[model samples]
Target: MDGKKKNLTTSWGAPVGDNQNSMTAGARGPVLIQDVHLLEKLAHFNRERVPERVVHAKGAGAHGYFEVTNDLTQYTKADFLSEVGKTTPMFIRFSTVAGELGSADTVRDPRGFAVKFYTEEGNYDLVGNNTPVFFIRDAIKFPDFIHTQKRHPKTHLKNPNAVWDFWSLSPESLHQVTILMSDRGIPATFRHMHGFGSHTFKWVNEDGDAVWVKYHFKTEQGVKNLTEEVATKIAGENPDYHTEDLFNAIGNGDHPEWTLYVQIMPIEHAETYRFDPFDVTKVWSQKDYPLIELGKMVLNKNPENYFAEVEQATFSPGSFVPGIEASPDKMLQGRLFAYSDAHRYRVGANHNALPINRPRNEANTYQRDGQMRFDGNSGDSVYYEPNSQSGPTESHQNKQTGFPVSGVAENIPYDHNDHYTQPGDLYRLMSDDERERLVNNVVGAMKPVESDEIKLRQIKHFYKADPDYGERVAKGLSLPVPQNV
Candidate 1:
């Protein structure tokens, strides 16, 4: 060997005697077990891929800081929203809910708008979607609802018959179904659409008084959507158009931004409210609960590495700081556990330690090692709580006040199942040209169902929303217009 030293080595840095051939009795013979280098290489490669997210598998993410422009300390004790000009580092992931990891970005689907804030207290994740409402109120039908969105088991392809069949059976899906079939279903770009924390959340003040709230992140770039023709053309031309646009925009110093706003309702209001406050399928009318300006979110920086940052980043609705807490929304309640479970499976139990998911400040918790213990294993500290020794302790100042829930702990039915009124209102709100486009879009999507039964069933739900809306769609599709349903 030269003085500089020259030698072949294995992945573990062990000196390898021979790399060109495996340990075998004869040339081109079967490999031997002693070929540990080969075994290690193949084994690691085999397990390299983690589980893909069941929803929002295709996404792009970035790192930025949320600067508090207004003082909301009286409304929320969340450290990030404490003082004027105070800034907290945040990570945001934009995604499509109904597509696989390799799916096209311009497809007709709701985009996921998830954010994780690294605060002095801990990481607070605001997990929401681009739309203000969901298809169903209760969480029990989530799996079934998603099944209809995905490919059929038998044909292994997206079946409109299956989709329409499911939607017709569940009248509660009319509102979201209408939205999905409209022009807004396919966003022109990620930067042009708004985001919402669809579930009703609770906000506790420093005085331990609470109010029901919902988040709305209005795009500062303005609300713009692609027409069905435009979206379809773009999808075919470039599957990753949205992802490329975001990354390139940030790269060129053109950061996309959104104005943060919230709609607050008093705790007492929910008790005597006309509609169920916690229903994810419904929205609080602006006439009722007006919006309050919070701050702004500007995506000024792109991720350093897609796999290290974007792919590994996780956000859970359960991850709340001092002021934020959950509401009685059944969908939100289910997500409190499900989101973290998804992260654990996709990343690992110690996913919080990952740079993208980890907090800026030191994390103190009783939870210990699992897979991938990268820390000094807590450095011989006491794992159990309530110890005399100085370990981590809970802050009484950060405790949230719980609201009263007085229903029997059984399979209670959803109180607000009237789903047509809002969709009807939405239809009537559209301009004449927009209404024609919406109807045409609905008819175009429904016409290819290849099943008259499924077509009529879905059309009936449209009739329930508005007779004019149903007649226009039925006329376009050449289907029998239901006189009355």
Candidate 2:
């Protein structure tokens, strides 16, 4: 575009004589060690790939800004939402969970909706999914749950027996399984679906008052999804359909936006709530706790480099600012450590120093040398705090508010946990047609299971949720409905 030709140079700016041919003995013998250019090129090529993510590996990202539409300082002391019309630059990555880097975008899997806000205090990451509920509430079950979703080790193929066996045994998975089998499982595009902070979080105001909140990013473009038939066809035709759609939309200046809403519950309500407030597999009734308008997020810029800005960009639920904090959700609590540890291993120890992952404000920490310590290693400053040297100190104002706890340190299940009511209610609320479609989807997904016991066990759970639901699925699977059920 500049209409000028430039010479090629090595990484260190040294000019090259000829790249097509390497230095060799007698021009036809083995290559010579004197070929520094050949060695550099081969070495760099060998290390080109970083390790892929354990989950949500296939993704698309964009640059954007979040503008507060209403003042929420009464609930959260976060500066980005301190006043009306305040805009904070942000980045978002929309991904498919349980997929590798080359998976199809239209697969029947939960979509990941993670956001990183470049705030004055620090980088605040909200890692979530499109659905409001998940398969399991406890993090200890995560590895096993994911193993079922992935290819079997022996067969190297998707195993329906493994999937149905796990889901049948874990009744808590029914809620998410039902949703995934429905039409909403395959979103039409990244811009056409809703995003959610599925885990409950804590918002602390300046007065140290904390409230439990759940975030919902309702799509302004409206919800659109692909049917099972269409999604399958598109997957074969264009595996990168969602990624291409997002890029084209932003490039054509038709930016997509989502309105941010939060369901806030008083901290006192946790004790008496019908369902566990911190459970990842449950949802709060909107009638009891309504959504409060927060702001709007608009993605208007596409990344110049997909590898640098999207693939290498890392986020973790642990990256919290001052006003926002973690809840007692077991799954979320595990992610606070798991996500960052995975990033450190997949990327590098200094992954935060990457431009795409860096915070807007200067990072002040006593952390010293690690792999890829790029920020000049903090310019030789004192690496430890509470020393006799001039270094950064802790802020008393940013201390987390303490909550009382009374429990023995042992592996125990939640005392008042009930995994059925909410999912039952969900089934009852669906229309006759929706219920039929759901039953059909479930039957189709479960038909491949080799175990009759697993099938009957899962059908029983469906029956417990709703008799009609169980009966329909039983008919579809050609299995007789149990008289006891």
Best candidate per lDDT, number? 2
Candidate 1 lDDT by residue in tens digits, 6-100: 77787768898876777886888677888898788789889877787899999999878788777767777787898888888898999999889
For each candidate in the order shown, give its overall lDDT on alpha carbons.
0.87, 0.92
- Give candidate 2's error at residue 251 in angstroms: 0.5
Worst 10 residues of 1 by lDDT: 398-407
Kindly report which residue stretches of model 2 are placed more than 4 angstroms away from their true locations once superposed. 1-3
Model 2 — TM-score against the truth?
0.98
lDDT of candidate 1 at residue 302, scale 0 to 100:
91
RMSD of each predicted structure:
2.9, 1.1
User: For model 1, what is the C-alpha lDDT against the true structure?
Assistant: 0.87
